[model samples]
Target: RAGLRFITCHEAFASAYSDGTAVRVTTDPERTQAEFARCSAADCEGWRSLVAIYRRIAPHVLPFTNMPLPSGAAAFHALRMAAGLRGAMLDLRHVIFGSSGQLVDRFFRTDAAKGAVLPWGFHQDFGPAVKGGAAFAFVAALSAHMKGLVVAQGGADAIVSALRRLIEDGGGTIRTATQATEVLVEGGRAVGVRTSTGDVLSASRAVIANVTPPLLFGQLLPAHSVPDRVRKRAMAFRYGPGVFMVHLALSRPLAWKAGDDLHRFMYVHLNGKPDEIAGTYAQCTTGLLPSRPVIVVSQPTHADPSRAWAGCAAMRLQVRAVPAIIAGDAAGTIRGRGWADIKDAFADRIIGQLEEHAPGARDVILARHVMSPEDFERENSNLIGGDCVSGSHHLDQNYLRRPFPGWTRYRTPVERLFMIGASTWPGGGVNAASGYLVAQDLLGQASKKAPQRGIER
Candidate 1:
């Protein structure tokens, strides 16, 4: 809470940063803004409990929220949206000899490590989801003027639109059709880029490549400039499976077997237990989706009504696994019994599961968009075949080990070349924290001559 100097619920409608401009929260075009106001700040508010309160609850209590307990069936579903606690739940390796092994006082240390790194970076390394720390970080950056209001291509349309307003407000340039091809380094000195259009645009300050690791090291910078360790690691890097997303326009909000309010966000899926999760991960490791895959179902439409058209809801159902999920190759999979023919046919089965968790699922579904891993790879190269995180988020490939051993802070061996994407540290997604971090590094360098303001976190 102390770190979060500001939180931007909606900026296009209202500049959260006090710049003598604040739009009314209740406005027509800002309907999205109004809806965002309702979606709870699950992180900030839930941190209000005392240490004693936490002592009474650890594994039983979700670290992000202080909500009530979930029923067994609901808890099973919640595992998918978990901050990645599938293995932790069944971990008896270091337990104190045949104890019930519940999350008691002694196990507080398990969550302690989270507190240590978490308070620093927004990518808290929990699980599939984030704790809104990046939002706080970006809003703080905007307020402090450390980073520009201009946020480029963060997957979320709402966030992108608000940032666009800020960029346009600041009279900043929004260059499009400019795909950065290669970094032009002269005698180990940082130079600029060679765009696909053959335009040689030079950065007066720094060269930050906001693309994937393979693209940055392999494509943007030359092979020679990259160190062996970086090269070896990047080469060793595993490009995980693509994600399959099902976006549905529902006719009404979902009805859930709700125990706690937060249960609404709890992800329900098919896989039964740890063995199932393990088997799924194993299948993904070798290249295949688990026979019965685990799916994460998030109804953002339930939380934010503006996400859909009038009388329509948006359903986001996703699963991240290897190519085998989609039968390796769509053509081959379809040729014999393709991933699509199978998955599309099974979509109704998934819908049946959704109907159980969300009573109104089938009844409300008006139109649907099913996205497979193959589809994702074709859409965004950054996704690297639906590995939405640029690359795998495994322990070995995460943190300092990310991209390369020594390269973490967006900088490469070649002078002035920096990185800023999900591929970069504190990796991945709508979190503009990576861009802000990279921007801070760039602005600090840029201010050395251009006279910019003091750098802030």
Candidate 2:
């Protein structure tokens, strides 16, 4: 970078991946128009607040839609005109709190029992944006949980050390890197793992899985090992959208139009509504760009000073629900451009969007970084499709049903192998709730095994 230098990381390490993307769409177009008309007048003041927000946060989200009007009556009338012109207006608040009945509708198809739907408001994780400089907003959720907890960090060594401590506390012993190549089966009991490294770890009691259902039953374990019902359930499992990220280094501090201080709301761009986001997803399936891609940006230098040049700030832009490969086999050949050029294009687009809000923002940057899905996969094997959250946060694939039913625990189909990645419960994030949960299970299992009561199985 021309202006940035880092003391810790050779090149300051910064990553951006879509943590959240919300949409606004109406199944019935006419009704959508009617709602807008009514909202314009009664919520005129709120309307101004919304547009001002978009303009101030431009390049992130533009407040008002097509027929921009200064007054309530005008907004009400303009909404209809814009709709006819294919311009859809949205309220950012609605994305987080509004019930997309559509999302609820999708729950119906999730293969749960009839009438089984994701209980609303239960899908949120407090840690999504905290690492990106949102500690002030999320600190409450931690203390709010009355039952206190402790955490230890150090990565691979830390995980093993924590496990050993739990074991000394009378927890369980772990099999490290056995790679559960297969789940050995004889009489229907899970048995154990046949690791790629040629080690077989067998289970006399229960075998827990550290991987997702796809990896567990499909790859590690043979088809016969899974019961018919369980197999079908696993097959029916669905995943949410993946992510795209862009990292940037600038010669100057990122200045937002709204306020100099970074606001806690994670930045999002909704130039197009739900349809546009879906179109992007569809294109991703066929390897094409969607109608329009959504991006989320954050000014990390705004929070951690160590990320950029002495006076300059660093920023990250992200796209979610996008195809990892777009526009002519995006993989293998990056549209024939080097990574730098590709990243600059993305940054340029973001800056163009910024012009609406902070005009002339593009000139401030000095360096850039961009990562595709392949890039993400290369960096962190845990992030499938570059989605930092592991699996999509869908209802069934979340919480108890995650990675597949009946295997939320960290123990695997093998005896001592365990998973401590984001694929497990309390899914994803640096919080490591899944790891903590696994540790709890291990502690309990070890306590039960310690006395060695004969024939307990």
Candidate 3:
């Protein structure tokens, strides 16, 4: 483990565009209304109302700042308050099933709606079962508006570099390209690990696996070592959805038809009405790729110019809520061809969609790299089915029930074996809550066993 230093950048701007009109989201609450005024006068009032609801509910939903999220009764109470319902019990299931579209519909008139529901879909890792929520979705959007969109100075790789430095400086050795074959269990305890390269590394304290539940229980450990019930639960672990990423080295920045102000934002969501998002989710669940998938167009080079060439820029385009395996194509252009067979065709469709908002996006591309769900799975075994979050964040798969119930504290049935990462509580994103919690628990246990040293007593 390493003690890493982080350099933070401000989330200065973000935007959501639909029907050629863009609503700018800023960190400054006062500027938000003015910014929305640039998009539409009718929607300005709706935006204001949405922000008001966010202010009221955000505090209740995210009660703690620098601590682990509260669970059980306290979590239930917070969720109820966040939902703005008095006397009614609101659980995560209610939130997940409840329509965020309904909440948006209440705040914004049909004509005034500019895809406000889109942010919730993207923010909550929108999937078939995830309908978004009044409390969860609103809080996610509000947090972004309040905190602004922040990124590392030199891109995400900068954080990895800093962590690597910390590890090396602390005399920790890192081995790459070594596949862990089995978790060596001795006397009903996780003692060490055996690698495919015929090397056995022993753990003095514990062995923590930052892997998906299936791999951790099914592959990394002997079949006879794990309990049947635990193995069955792991096998039943459900993945949310996969993402298709296209990284481009643009000859120049995107020229939005709306205005140059679009270049200031870190992310621009290209979505339509709330119903469109719901349709996409439905398609994904049924194993069909949406004809018009939600595209999260990120201009990282706009935030940190150092990432690209002197006169060019770098961009990342993400298509979310797509199936990992190809069952059918909603567009009907590439049916049952599989990701390997239709990855390029799918990328073309994605590029065409981008061109709708940012014209000449295809012409400006100097180079492009595409990663389909299949590619993602090959790159990281833990990303089962290319699910970016490792597992679903649905009601049954989140929080204390994550990776399966009764193992919330990162402990396994086998002593000294622990689990962490996206599959655990505080699921997904750049936040390292899972790792931090596990480290604290391990440290506390270690301190308890330390030999006392008092002068001569």
Candidate 4:
């Protein structure tokens, strides 16, 4: 155990959702449904049905989130999953093939409830109408309900600290500020890595890379060592829409019109109606900055009061589905040439939108920091265009075909070389399943290859 502290978020019950209107939700399905019923009675029944189905299929579906695909366990799990979906077989098919918009349309009757569900899909960095995006959204809902918006106490750095401690305890050295330039190969097998400083680090067994497909194939591994097909596919990996984040150090907590109860929750999704999100995604894909962007408001201080200064709060507004490159502004207002030139204006625009829900939200701001898509890419090259998810989770790019069609096993063409991280199977988020599965594979192989020895006297 890492001795890490956690807050289950049950005490912080309300999760706010707004699309011109507001709905307060909690982990409790019945209570959450009741909140929506105030707006539309039909939406209540639909949510009841959705929750019932979720309860039935969650046992089968939740396992896949952390489990490694392309393994024998996965095949067995699939069989169990099929049995689990016995009555809901047709619905399962629709979930897999249909869009998130369609799924919401099938269940929710009111725009209020639909808006709440639509943004869950946007977290996958795709339009709500994109096929296979519904599954991602539904799985996310299931995960949230199951886990109750879990947060590591003292912030995300606590996770890093725990991992660092674990690695060091295991006699593993961590080199920060060191960039690995190439994965060294000898006799068609990966030996280690050459750092940016040209220092060669040797590995006894394997060299695992936590990098995007493009970086792994195009930059790290020698072109001659990789198969032509694999290399080309990796090179052609598509990233989704970029993210624009704004951090606000508030003199006081946000006063939401939705209710003071909402201040308890960490996250609040804003402007997330189906049509609105669809239009925003279309605008971003066409190289135009969205005039009305979907925003995820995070008030981590609510969940963990220690995260902020005394009597003050820290908030993060993540503007969803933004263009990686500025071609034009959909609003035809801002005429900036680049994201750097427009990010401040964009932050103001976003803050103005926030003010609508939380009256005079701007007045409480102690300070603000904005990270444009360009800034995100500069901070982490893996973000390639600020796609925090590393790569797209489109049907063609996820599941068995993740990273590459035949490379989903994490083992690459080069022996003793493995790939992990957001670019691999589970496809992003902070679950760490990719690394865990790869470690299992390597340990399994090592155990199998261990030579048998006779008992000594």
Q: Give lDDT tens digits, candidate 1, residues 398-452.
A: 5555655667656677777777676765556455666676676667666786845
Q: Model 1, which residues run further than 4 Å from truth? A: 1-155, 227-229, 257-272, 322-343, 356-360, 446-457
lDDT of 3 by residue, 1-457 (tens): 3333333324443545545666667677767777666646656787787776556545555543223444455566665665664433343334445556655665565432546444554545653234444545665666778786667776787788888888788898888899999999998899999999999999999998999899999899888888899899988999888988999999999888768778767777776457567778888878898899877788877668888988799998888678887789998887555788888888899899888888888999999999998899999998777788898877678655787887776788889999988888777778787788778888989899998788586
Q: lDDT tens string, model 2, 73-177?
A: 346654644554332334333332234333323222221110011111112211121111112111211121111112222112455565467666675666655
Cα lDDT of model 4 by residue, 1-457, tens digit? 5868888775223334443346666678667777779869998888777777777777776688677777788889999889768888887777777899998999988777887677888988768778988887777765565567888888899989999999999999999999999999989999999999999999998998989989999999998998899899899999988999999999999888888777677678877888788888889899998888888888778778888889999899998678888999999988886998999998999999888889889999999999998999999989999999988888889888888787887889999998999888888888889888888888988999998689675
Strongest candidate by lDDT = 4
Against the true structure, candidate 3 reaches a TM-score of 0.88
TM-scores, all models, native as reference:
0.61, 0.52, 0.88, 0.96
Residue 155, candidate 2: Cα error in Å is 14
The top-ranked prediction according to TM-score is 4
* Span of ten consecutive residues with least summed lDDT in model 2: 113-122
Model 4 clash pairs?
none
CA lDDT scores, all candidates in order: 0.47, 0.44, 0.74, 0.83
Residue 116, candidate 2: Cα error in Å is: 30
Question: Candidate 4, after superposition: displacement of residue 208 in Å?
Answer: 0.5
> Between 1 and 3, whose TM-score is larger?
3
Worst 10 contiguous positions by lDDT, candidate 3? 1-10
Query: How well does candidate 3 match the true structure, expressed as C-alpha RMSD?
Result: 3.6
Residue 118 in candidate 3, Cα distance off native in Å: 2.9
From the highest lDDT down, the ranking of the candidates is 4, 3, 1, 2
